[model samples]
Target: MLRQLGSGAQYLATDINQHAAETTQATLEAHGVHADVIVTDIMSGLDKRLAGMVDVAVVNPPYVPTHVEEVGCRGIAASWAVGLNGRQVIDRILPAVREMLSERGWLYMVALEDNDPSDICHLMSEMGNLREMFQIDAADYMMSICGDDSLKELSSPGKSGSIFYLSQDERFVIKTLRKTELKILLKLLPKYYNHVRAYDNTLITNFFWRPQDYSERRKKGSLCCDEKYVLH
Candidate 1:
């Protein structure tokens, strides 16, 4: 399905069972699609060559809960013999996919309700911090947000005197913080950062930037702030 959707993009498929790899290749051939199919255990031995280069990754890992001994078994059983909570294969694939992705990469994964998709998302979020792993410059992202001409103001129903602006891509929300709110956040910043770093399933909103005194540098169509701006 991904092959048909992204026909112009390169594809690489891997499986632990040689038969499964062969079947995948045959299916691609039948559909007149080209992809490199390899017999390997979840991208093993391909890291050095492909790390941090993949633009998109699709995963449908083995997710059936079964006895520990059933995992890695030969033939058809290897397809869905994930042990215990069905996270054995899924957990391994998460970090591997994170390593394989480019800075702007996206991942599409299949998960059962029993597999706990929320926890999986949280785990991937911790593993795929672009600023830490990819060394993306903070200033570059700030420039993109500040220079965006399509930012739209959202009406606030609350009586906190706060103004809200949504980014052009809708990936970020810029909120003008009051002096008291800024002080509280500044005081909590250290503890908050540490808490989020330690907890994989933390539900806190990710605050990207807290720029101070942006009134002088505001552009014509850019966001304006009297004191502080918080981007999340």
Candidate 2:
């Protein structure tokens, strides 16, 4: 990314990670490159007006949830980053990207397996952009910054340890997830988090009954069962 920026491309950079944004600014400034760095939460809603006008917007958005307060990130994590996870991030950003992009302008985004590169391309295609605009494809997630999260801690199996059998030992690290990435992972998340686990590790017994996103419901319909956080 730094190399691409240094090649004399007029690029705009943004991050939900404030520290990362600061680092980006410092790095760009050191190379004598001036990039527009905006420290705002996209989840709070994006500035479609400004975003839709840029020629090319480069982004490597967050792949994981961050709970701490970061440097340049003034607001909460972007909708895609934390709230609805990866799918929402792309859904929220793509529209504005379409608006900001010049008629023939291109958006260079690092596609992830979690979010499905094909889905990204499909969405872009649906937006009236030239089908293929030089996309560098990637498979498997780049675990460049895989830090431990309270995902396990934040999940629950309804009726204490009696119902939910969590295989994730709090002592565990992030295991290599599937190619489907966060999309598949989301399917494993216990609906209501912070509940106790079942005594048996055979299956996660707890379930959180909560509201579903309008879109998810529209596609999968109401889940006969909430996303099962089983002991996989």
In lDDT terms, how accurate is model 1? 0.69
Model 2: CA > 4 A from native: 1-10, 43-52, 64-85, 129-232
lDDT measured at residue 180 in model 2 versus the true structure, 0 to 100: 42
lDDT of 2 at 185: 36
lDDT of 1 by residue, 51-113 (tens): 677898989898888898997687788788888778767866775677668778899999888
Please identify model 1 stretches exceeding 4 Å from their true place.
1-8, 130-193, 196-232
Query: Which lDDT values do the candidates have, in the order given?
Result: 0.69, 0.42
* TM-score of each model, paired residue for residue: 0.55, 0.41
User: Cα RMSD (Å) between model 2 and the true structure?
Assistant: 17.4
| Candidate 2, run of 10 with poorest lDDT | 136-145
Q: Every model's Cα RMSD, please? A: 17.6, 17.4
